[model samples]
Target: MLTNVPGYPRIGSGRELKKANEAYWAGTASLEKLQLTARQLRRQNWEAMQQAGIDLIPSNDFSYYDQVLDMCLMTGTIPARFKPLLERLASPQSLELYFAMARGYQKNGLDITAMEMTKWFDTNYHYLVPEFDTTQQYRLLSHKCVEEFREAKSLGIHTKPVIIGPLTFLLLGKIKDHSLHLHSLLEQLLPVYLQLLTALQEAGATWIQIDEPYLAMDLNPAIHQLYINTYNRIHQAIPGLQLLIATYFDALGDNLATALQLPVQALHIDLVRAPQQLTTVLQQLPAGMQLSLGVVDGRNIWKNDYQLSLALINEAVQAIGQDRVWISSACSLLHTPYDLDLEQDEQVLTREIKHWMAFAKQKLHEIADLAQIATGNNTSLAANMAAMQAKQHSPLIHKPAVKARVAALDESHATRKSPFHVRQESQEVAFQLPLFPTTTIGSFPQTAEIRQLRAQLKKGTISSEEYHQRIKAAIAETVKWQESLHLDVLVHGEFERNDMVEYFGEQLEGFVFTQNGWVQSYGSRCVKPPIIYGDVQRTHPMTVAWSSYAQSLTKKPMKGMLTGPVTILQWSFVRNDQPRADTTFQIALAIRDEVSDLEKAGIRVIQVDEPAVREGLPLRRANWDAYLQWAVQAFRIAVCSVLDDTQIHTHMCYAEFNDIIDSIAAMDADVITIETSRSQMELLEAFARFKYPNEIGPGVYDIHSPRVPTVEEMSSLLQKASTLLPARNIWVNPDCGLKTRNWPETEQSLRNMVAAAVQSRSAVLVN
Candidate 1:
């Protein structure tokens, strides 16, 4: 009746902490080989959740770049522009002032920038937001969850420690003085989380898991009385600290009697995302309270249906009986993928779909066999009920012409045969581009010899005519280096893709793939996704032969990138037996037949992208209009079958498009390339208070900040995005992909972003 695990998978199953934090940010590794690969990936993720017996094993969820920026450098919550790199990186801490506040400090000449990242609630896993102000204070800087709980109690492993809750760290921070009273910063951050949970209950932690995922969001009534005065002032300052709070992805609806008036002993809940709030948190169980039950699916790879987690662990062990019921993980397997048995023998799914599948070390053995079949020890529920009846009669999961083209789509297959001012006067008379046009957001710097010729053409030792004659000579040397950075809408440089949704989930049909499943997606990035599992279709023209061979080596308007069917169904590992808007309208009619075969292969500027469509919204604005009306009709059924002089674009990353700027201008997408340089153009104040009529490339340089942005800092963020939009609906790029940057900072940041779109088209012809 025990087994918890609100976190694990600190990126190692061959990411080795993304190659030791990019070889210690390229000084070729050290700081004792990146703290010996973060102490051997936190001792192989605490020896694989203590050999999967896991009784609440958590310990600071290891991070080099975000456990909410390690609780904003352990509650000192710096952000006054990283307090002068945390007072020249010393007694305000260092690891280069925590990677110059998570990447943005121009070596020694001290240039700063980086604090603001989003999506960690609606997880595609990015965090670093915490800015706080109204004279922000709070103290206990970094005991790093009590030195990773005495480094897992000197490896004898008595773990638990997890931390983040001073009301979800001031409700995932960034108050920046909106007269900053998140209840006076959670009562000035609850005595620095009661001196960091009384130093993890004097370093032998009985149970500390604090993480209050904002009690599964959508709270009010003063954030449910600031989670009842921050857990009744840490249960009256450590009244024998047990804590465990944790809610996850969703539901705790009407905040379940303010989460059973929190005098926290244990709560957990997310029975694979709101299993009808487990009959109201086991009928409000509080006497000697303890429930846990998250019942496994920590953001999907799918598999543990040990008869639906032993019927919700035998109804929370018959209403909190078996020693107050436990069985965890519906939240942090850090959004899954560390080991589907390290995806051995190059798994492409079918060995009966790899026994239905399960990563994060088989979800810590499905939360220790749903706590040994709710304590009866029913032998791992007979091979997870024969891989859940062989994945429900799998004839490799149905198609019938991809369910009759997502049941013959409607809304005229998602509109667009010309609008946004008639596709901006037919894309300005078909590409006679100039005023402020510069492009990118399709990859460019995936080097290391293009990931070793896409790993020697997937190890057939590089043949398919020597990997397309070395990917058509790296797409004719990146279309002559984006025409020597004069860049006016050009981009073949996907460099024979690997992941922008696993290169269109490897040519689409019911997708499989996994040679070490990857995952991370932020700092030192990771990806590898592609799991979708059955009934998405278009098995050809997946990027019209390298975008019609980079549009016959470019005459400028080349683009054609593609990842969008709601970012290939919000970055894959999907198929939970249908209706994620019917697998995003069968991956938007297979990216609308690869955007009408990339406009019949003459490819006139495609793009697509959908950077995880605001990481699939719905963290409850009463479920964001049924998930933004089928994610703006699956990005208008994947670029509405082209030709309003075919332009189409779409990019979006750090998505806070001010509460979905009318579902991102109803995703009509005639050019949207967002992510305003880490909020410098401040996400162009939501396309300038929604006067947003398409075309807004607003990224003037922050390809995830390695810091080479300066042609007067990309012409002062394209002159603060032309005083917030319509200097002819602006377009200058770079806030997203330069595939995790490096070709001398992607050629001096697109030559300081095409000299800041030619100095914002000479300040728009000097006003």
Candidate 2:
């Protein structure tokens, strides 16, 4: 019984990659230093897998930024805007070029916007969306897959090179040229995959793991045929080399029969998310295909169930031989934290709750332990069962009061006092303002001094009162600056907080923080997701003091910022013991308390951000309605507590909202701000088509890229948005938060954005 996994966490336990990448980007560290750090991290990851008894270690799964972006550079899917840099910059500066593509180029007298970015499938991790044109061509652009495979082999490790499958790569990317459909690039992308596969074969690779997560998605007959033809082509081209097609994050569903027809040696399915699909897969499984049973939960942190996994492995072995049955994590451990042992502080995740959890390192050991237990070794089963039993019976987990409160809640709790039209009128009276009101998406740039203040408070070097004063001073500076910018609908800049979700989770009950449990959200951006071990409750007002204080600073309407219920639930390592919807409802109740508190404190406007709600939509369309029902209910529960006169705003980013426009409308927020600049108001088209009644702030400036747009550029985007939806229904804003940006770029971008808005306003007045 061999233990296999599709991928492991690439970010180190301490986030060494993040620090090094930031240093290199800041020019404080050399390129050699960054490359060395990357190599060291890769070696450590490979060694960790080897030590954990992983039979099929994965290489090329580690990425400097994102694996999809790597695939983009590999397949010559480079955007045309980088042609000059590509031609001018020599080979040694390839890493620089890659970083330029990931983060847009702002220096060297060039201002190129980075490619569009969005949620990768249904996770917090973002990937750069590859842009394709009508004249797209594919070739062996980056030999990173081969280079990495050989790099690992140099250290005496036999590894399986992992690459995103061609079809999935094509499916995930967007077509920049309207003349091109994504599927039309199949022929163009195939030869490059063949070339790469051939190179891997020549480099002493026996097996290649081609990740086709697209298999788990909804597909029509045409797409199914695409899969059949694709695998057949690969099979004919490289007969000697074995290929493992890994699918995860969902069940194969109706595509199971079609999946069996593919010419791959082995196939992996996500048994964690969709265990019921195993019976169907076993029934339709081809004669010679190896089955990888993904029993260990990869997307979560909960310890694996030994008995359940052993039984599934036994059942599979009974159907096929033991040699053909393998155990692995359900999906990439990229979604989870790197290590759990780092949570040494007993004040955080206590020992009792820690026993029932597993990070990436623990998950690897769980995979190995499962294989060992299935093969007549029962050493670890007793401990696993003890932890499971403790969790089931623990007073820390179950709360009758919380459960009763949820049960007592009725439909009235999830409904606003009035509809949007009525609320809009009340809000207009509440906060009198001009058209195209300008505001940021809550946070301003988190500067070094502000971070130092928080660090000092944590370390006990600064008194609580001193820290409070410093935060107030930072807020004062921010408020004064926004006033100078002549912006409307101000925020406190969220200077006292950390990550949007983590800060709220810290003040709430039933959620545990981690000292070093970092997971990569994107390049150089890591988040430590709190663990939801028990029933949630709000202990105190999370942001009322800050919002009230900021509102006192200015006569203008100050928006109260909060991480909405769905986003909190989606971002956290939620408890597996109860239904996710139950936990979300608990969180909603908690946020509802805070919303009421803020409104009571004279906060006229509130912004509850549900950036993760769209990402939380079920992968299969069949399951979406139920999820959306609960998701929308949770959001409504959070904001509906406020009066109709209190203008409630919600912000969502990155994910496409076209399909879920009804649900978006169902959230019943008075205003919705979305990330649209990367798409050049393309997302606004959906809202326009849907005739979304509420006010929308189609972000005219791309905040993700550091390149500050010219006033003209932003006005152009505003004009584009106005043409789609009524100009009266539009607000002016940036795409997302400024937490990751610097003060210089953030100031310049906001200044340009304000100029654009004012320019738009002047034009409208003239009309």
- What is the per-residue lDDT of model 2 for residues 1-767, given as tens digits with 9 covering 90 to 100? 88897898887888998999889988899989998999999999999999999999999999999999999889888888887777778772288788888988977777778888899888899999988886556788899999999999999999999999988888888877887765678888888999999999999998899999989999889989999998899889988879998999899998888888999999999999989898889888999899999999988889988988888898898888889998999988888888888889887778988888899999999999999998889999999998888888989887788999999889999998888888888888878878888998999989899999999999999999999998999999999999999999899999899899999899888998888888889888999888899999988888999899999999999999999999999899999988999999999999999999999999978999999999998899999999999999999998898788999899999989999999999898989999998888899999999999999998888777778789999999988887888777789999898898899888888899999999998988998
Q: Which 10-residue window in model 2 sums to the lowest lDDT?
A: 84-93
**Candidate 1, after superposition: displacement of residue 358 in Å?**
12
Tell me the TM-score of model 2.
0.99
**Which residue pairs overlap in candidate 1's backbone?**
none
**Candidate 2 backbone collisions, by pair:** none
- Candidate 1, residue 626: the lDDT equals 91
Question: What is candidate 1's lDDT per residue for 1-767, written digit by digit as tens?
Answer: 78888888787888888888888888887888888889889988898889878977888888887888888878888777666556566567567888888887887667888887888878788888888875546698878789888987888989888877777877776686667677777777778879878878887799888778887778879889877877887788779988888888888888889988989878887877779889877887778888888878888888878887788778777776889888888888877788876565644655667778888888888788777767778887887887788788988789787788678788987898767898788889988988888888877777798889888877888798988888888889878877877888777777777777777787777888888888797777878888887887876776788778777876777877877787777778888886788888888888888788888878878878787777788777888899889988888987887888888888887868787888888888878887777777777886788788887887777778788877887888788777777777788878788777778878877887787678678777887
Q: State each model's CA lDDT, in order.
A: 0.81, 0.90
Model 2 regions lying over 4 Å from their true place: none
- Weakest 10 consecutive residues of candidate 1 by summed lDDT: 342-351
- What is the clash count of model 1? 0
